[model samples]
Target: MDRLSQEKPLKILVVTQYFWPENMRINNMVEGFVAKGHEVTVLTGQPNYPEGKIYADYRRDPAQFSNYHGAQIVRVPIFARGQRSLTLALNYLSFFASASTIGSYKLRGQSFDSIFVFGVSPIMVAIPGIVLGRLKKAPAFIWILDLWPESLRAVGVIKSPRLLGWAGKVVSWIYNRADYLLLQSRSFDESVKQYCTRAISEDRLVYFPSWAEDDFSGAAPVASDLLQRDDSVFTVLFAGNIGDAQDFPAIMEAVKAVKADLPVRWVIVGDGRASQWLARHVAEHRLDNVLLLGRHPLEKMPALFAVADALLVSLKTNEVFEKTIPGKVQAYLASSKPIIAMIDGEAAKVVANSGAGMVCGSGDALGLANIVRSMGALPATERERMGLLGRRYYFEHFSKAILFDRLEVLFRKATLRRSDK
Candidate 1:
């Protein structure tokens, strides 16, 4: 028999609104599957994310079909994610409508062993996977990165109890239909279990954590101007989306509190709705120590981390946020950089358990200032040791290779169970 025929390969269809070119974990997951001899296909929308406009090449003719690496990619029409709430809502709903209609027609004839939905925000993205799974007789698996209704409320996106109730029903419907539900944080177990019906057993629920990209392990060369750092000061860097959930106002307060006393610099590297506001705040306050470097490509992260004295992660105090771990935590750990977790609950626990760095309550400006001072006072050797511990913890638990292995087994189990049914 041919070597390729020695073992059967899996055919997986990934349903996600964001994919490659839109910095998402699903991109790495799909690439990993293709590397492991599994056939993969992605159904996603045009690449307009944090920035409300579509990318250059995709703008003119937004091709319906494309390929990345070895996996097939199917793109669908979607409204530009304009900053306004109406346009944003349309962007989300348009992807679902277009994907459902076009995806059904395009993928109906193709057979898949498993259908995987990567749910980051707006859980309705799973609809395509559920429909395709039923049509193709494949098991549908959902990896929940963000919980609905609760998340919407936490973000102040929807407030009315009646609206929340309807959203809750939609969530319950999706949960009931999915063959398997993978959660990123253990704290999410209870909330997710409450929605599980008699048809879905506890055994179908699995704790799945996101891991850092493989590229973050080592330093990569970056533009010198991108560094934008004072080599003498103790730098605390915050990288990723700067939004309401990040609780950047608290971070700004902390920076203001500490700048007068300590020789520390606060650097924020990313963009979002809050970017302009943050820039304005910094300008109005004339805070020279706080630098907003805007956004950079993913490839530059390693170099950026290499120069940083410590990495900062923060979230607003909310029940939903407490049960979630921000994806940047893994990247911070993988970079072998000491972290300063300014959040509560599960994420704080992860930093503490890993022996990576210090933690403070969310929105606690005074508490954050104190931790910054304490970390600044620590010896270089102590900080280096902490980074090493974080890196060790990452490889032992959250490395992509390890998590991907577990994911492959989960896919096989879901497929096997569906066949038995």
Candidate 2:
């Protein structure tokens, strides 16, 4: 008799260490859920990213950080990931310890239709979501952004085989605990399934990818003084996290080779763990062409992309990295800018397939330098065409609206599998 009886909105609880006020795609995902008439709650740590201190504004007025896109924000005590390995480890542990016990206590009586976990670098964050799902009798959907033990090895964070094996066990436990594991790259299917080594059915592993935000498309071309524009020089923009996973050493090597012979300039806009290292490397080597503009707001990225001749996306050379697609690739495509990818595997395949830009093996400094020269040599018309093709590919495969509908279907399907245990 009532519409509520016929159809009802979902109540989603999101678990992650990062959220709004901290620039991550999880915020967009939350916004999508809330925009679709779903009630959402985010359980996350206090905002402190790129820069390892809690946001001054957040500390001054906590209330302002509580609500975003109509979703409630639940904060937990977490150690700031100060630019050090020990601090980073403590930060991860604190979030896990706090969220698993105190975070659960904070949401004591709350119920949810689904638990969405932002499965970022450290896989331990998913534990709290799994716990919540079990306690609340809700299906837990984990968005696996990075592979755990493998990622750790790739980043040179954990090298011991025994330790990696133990980390793998944790990943296996997480895989077995969750109702659904949504993968960002389809290439991750084999690794995810084989690594789990359990009877993780095909339906349990869904290929759900990151998409370009609306901000990326048709952004106003506001000019910035950061650009080193000239008629002869090729302006290549590299953005997002400047971390170990990005292979900055290889980039510095590439810059050395290109600067001596070619008219190329690399404008980097972002900050992360490796920023200081990168800055030092740039200074020590006199890589004058390498411009480090530190960090900028998300609102400024579109403008940066709008003005750049081309975009650059790269990752460290590792087997684990090959099975992933960096979120920036999608944004570069959506921004209609020709991309130059210094990455291997799936992300490289995406750039090559989309006719967006050139691709080369990861950590190949000479190869990267060559591509920069070649791209710079290409006619303006050719570059524009590449951008167009990339944008077309974005609409074809990674449309956000389409993916949102797919999520709805996944949520419904997950509910069906809730009793799989």
Highest TM-score against the true fold, candidate: 1
lDDT of 2 by residue, 1-421 (tens): 2322324688889999998899888898899889988899999999998689999999999999999989999999999999788999999999988999999999999999889999997999999999999899999999999988878888888899999999999999999888899999998887788667678788889999999877886545567555535666788999998999899899888888888787787899998878899988888888888889988888778877877898999998889889989999999999999999999999999999999999889999999999999988899999999999999999899999889888877786666556455
Off by over 4 Å in 1: 1-6, 60-65, 218-225
What lDDT tens digits, residue by residue, belong to model 1 across residues 234-306? 9999999989999988998998889888999888999987888899999999999887888998888888888
- Model 2: weakest 10-residue lDDT segment is 1-10
Q: Where's the lowest-lDDT run of ten residues in candidate 1?
A: 1-10
The clash numbers for all candidates, in the given order, read: 0, 0
Query: Which model scores highest in lDDT?
Result: 2
TM, every model:
0.95, 0.94
